[model samples]
Target: MKTIAINQYGSAEEFKEIEMAKPQPKSDEVLVEIHAFSINPMDIAGRAGMLGSPFTDNWSFPLVLGWDFSGVVVEVGSDVEGYAKGDKVFGSASSSHSSDNGTYGEYIAVDNTELTHIPDGLTFDQAAALPIAGVTAYYGMKHNLDLQAGQKIFVAGGAGGVGLFAVQIAKAFGAYVATTSSENHRQLLEDLGVDEVIDYHKVSAVDVLHDFDAVFDTVGDVDTGLKVLKSDGKLATIATQPTEEQKHDQQKQVAFQFTYGTGADLDALAELVLNGKLKLMVETMPFSAENVIKAHQTIEGHHTTGKIVIHVKD
Candidate 1:
């Protein structure tokens, strides 16, 4: 199978197409023919060699970089159940550090527990866009922040990939939502039921917003989020880690949430999509090394309004 990978981590221009053996399912995995995948900030960070950890320090070159994918199952392991050769499945990979198992390929062998059936109304592109951002937003609001109806919450970077889903999920829970974004995205955020939209360029959220039940920080602006949060409010950040001082503060609750993809969480998100409570905004690109470079460039700008999805098969 043909796959795009980096000979070494550096620039987006380093991407190249190469031929590799098609992967087979492990005892608890399924072999998927990938149809689409989406780019995330982590992909850019990984390409820049900034995500080095003990788990990824020994990775070899020609590393495939991707996380969220939607594809059709072609083979299932003996241990897998409720999935067949023709099932339409989509989910995030459990680990993005694998050199050979990343989703930026024609085929991938993913664990069955991390895969879920794509709901009836979602397209491959939309399903591919949902895994990381959707699951992160869902888990942060539902688990970390414990957001509830009749309360107020503020989301930083409301136009971002994760922020878009956070705002909608808050609204669905009947919470009053306020967010910060550029003027260009104000109308769209309002259409998604945002009660207040602050232009981050002209004014700061700390100046006008206050007394929120929770703060969902998608930008690395935890200080601003803390300033605007009520004394008893909970704050969750996916962008950066909290300082030691901030973590030990007795007054406010702060947490750094790292999302893990699960079939159960994907099912919850699909239910929201089916009920018309969740929507995805995506820009589709053809699968190619050049387009992968272009997509990386667009996401590196840090101002993209929605997810950028690559059509891998059709």
Candidate 2:
């Protein structure tokens, strides 16, 4: 199997394509032949050696850095049920810090609990784009925010990977959604049912928006998010945590959310996709070291309109 990995963390230039032995499934795992994978902000952070502590502290050199993948199950573990060889599947990798279990390769041995079948109408690229970003948005809106129908919510960085999903999921839940993005993405987001689009470059959301039921901050701008939020509103951020002083100054509920993959959540997202409630906007790239570097650079710019996916097979 061939994998793009980093022997030492630094820049996107650190990516190198290398050959490694294929993995066999454990009793509760499945061996997947990866077809596609998507780039996320965490991949950049992992490549830059920012992922710390229990996640990557013990990971060895030549660590593979990816989490979202869609592929075909080539082999199933003895204890695994409801999945078989040749099943099309997609899911996020459960271990955040493991050198041996990343999706930036031809194969990955993943726990069965994290794997779910891709529905009939979905492609591998779209499925791969959904796991991390979709699950994060789903969990943040459904769990962290407890957003109710007819409520108002604002999403920062509405053009981002998670932000795109957040806006659609909010609309799916019947909430009146407003988000901040550049002029280029305004029409696209409006097509996805976003009620309001605020241009971040020309104006500030704090100046015009107020009294929101919830705020979903995908960018690290928690201060601006707090200013636009209602006194009793909840704010959920995946980008960064609010400082203690910031938290003390505002009595609103705030949480830093980290999403883990589960088959049930993936199934729910798949249902939304099948029902035409959720849509993915992805830019596909071929699998190569150069393209990986390019994708990292594009995502690091923090202005990408949608997910960037790498076609690993085919």
Candidate 3:
């Protein structure tokens, strides 16, 4: 099998293509023939040595580098049930640093629990785009902040992958969403059901908005998000966190400390997609070891309005 990996952890230049033994499944795992995978900011963060997670140092060079995948099952381990050969599955795979599963390859061996069936009408690129960003938005809104309908919620960086999903998910939940994006994405955000669009570069968070039931800082700009929180409201940040001094404030701010992709969460998201309540936009590109650098560059630029996918198959 052909795989794209980072033999060294310095730059996109470090990514290389190589032939590797195809992975097999364990009793609780399924082997998937990957059709497509998406590039995310996290992938760039991991490559840049910036995301200081436990999984960071666990991976050595020549390690696969993606989490979300859409593909068909080729083999199922003996203990795995409710799934079988030729099932169209898609979900976030745990990294190689954790359990030898990552999606930036022709094939991956994943625990059955981490895989979910893609919605019938969605394409491989669309399915590949949902897991990480979709679930992150869902968890942040449904779990962390406990947002309610008619409440005002702010989403920072609302035009990016996670941000775009956050906007739609917040709307589906009946919250009045305010998102920050460039002027170019204002109409896009409006179509996604955002009540207001604040250009972060032009309008500061505190200047344009105040008093919200929840604040979802998908881009991790904590200082701006905290300014608009109502007294009892909570703020969820993926980037910069609240300091001890800020946490002691009366607004009762909360930050999202990142969560692993879960089967239950994916099912919830899939339900939304299957029911025609959720819409995801995907930009698919061919996946080859040679083009991995181009993919990384596009993600790093942070300009893509939708998920950027790489099809692993020729």
Worst 10 residues of 3 by lDDT: 93-102
Off by over 4 Å in 2: 248-251
Worst 10 residues of 2 by lDDT: 92-101
User: Which candidate tops TM-score?
Assistant: 1
What is the Cα-based lDDT of residue 287 in candidate 1? 94
Error at 193, model 2, angstroms:
1.6
Regions of model 3 farther than 4 Å from truth: 51-53, 95-100
Q: Sorted on TM-score, highest at the top, how do the candidates line up?
A: 1, 2, 3
lDDT of 2 by residue, 206-298 (tens): 989999989999888999988888887898888888888657645798778867658888988988988999987889999998999999999
Overall lDDT per candidate, in order of appearance: 0.88, 0.88, 0.81
lDDT of each residue in 1-314, candidate 3, tens digit only: 88888766778888887777787778988899999999888888887777675656567556777888999999999999888999999988765434235688899888855678876777788788888888888989898888888999999888878888888888889999998888999887887678999887787879978888888887767777778888888888877766887776685767655766677888888777777667778777887766778878877876577888998763
In terms of lDDT, model 2 sits at 0.88
Better of 2 and 3 by TM-score: 2
